[model samples]
Target: MNKVYHLSSCNTCQKILKELNLPASFETQDIKEEEITKEQLEEMEALAGSYEALFSRRARLYRERELNKKELSEADYKELILDHYTFLKRPVILNNDEIFIGNSKKTVAAAKAAVHG
Candidate 1:
């Protein structure tokens, strides 16, 4: 199954989900309703190169909560995400060993190619 971790209100998340159109094999975890496991978040962060990639710096949560990236430790990040899932980025798609952060044609194509290859 493909698990998507994202905020429901994010337009990018909606757009990617709409574009993918994979309802049967896909499951979406609303950031507000479902907390991503620390291990899962850590894996994605490593794959994307940083916790910043896993978290949504551009989201209203960041601005409204006044979350400064530089002030957070790795543990703090994990706790924050666990406690408040809305801080995560939109459309964080997890398919097998692959993870897609945000939606872009290049990212989609690359993920597909890698999976199919």
Candidate 2:
């Protein structure tokens, strides 16, 4: 199944759902409710090439909490992400062999290709 990791009320998540047009094959998991695991975060971090890329830098919590990527340790990152799932970016789609960070035309197309190709 195509698992879309996202926040429940995020407009970007909704937009991805709309663009996907395949509810049957996809499953949505709200990041807040889903509770991102350390293992999963590690996997995403490895693929993303940096922990910062996994975070939603634009969020108020990010600024309020002062989550500067340069200052965080691996363990610190895990705790922060665990404490606030919203700290991570929206619509982190995980499928068989691909990880998509956000909703965009390029990302959607790549996801489609990764799923169908």
Candidate 1 lDDT, tens digit per residue, 45-71? 867777766666665677776776458
Candidate 1: which stretches are off by over 4 Å? Answer: 46-49, 108-117
Tens digit of per-residue lDDT, candidate 2, span 1-117: 377788878886887767766547777778787788887788777777777677666778777766654577656656777778877877787776568887678988887677666
Q: How large is the C-alpha RMSD of every model relative to the true structure?
A: 3.0, 2.5
TM-score of predicted structure 1: 0.70
Q: What is the lDDT, from 0 to 100, of the residue 53 in candidate 2?
A: 74
Candidate with the greatest TM-score versus the true structure? 2
The CA lDDT of each predicted structure is 0.69, 0.74
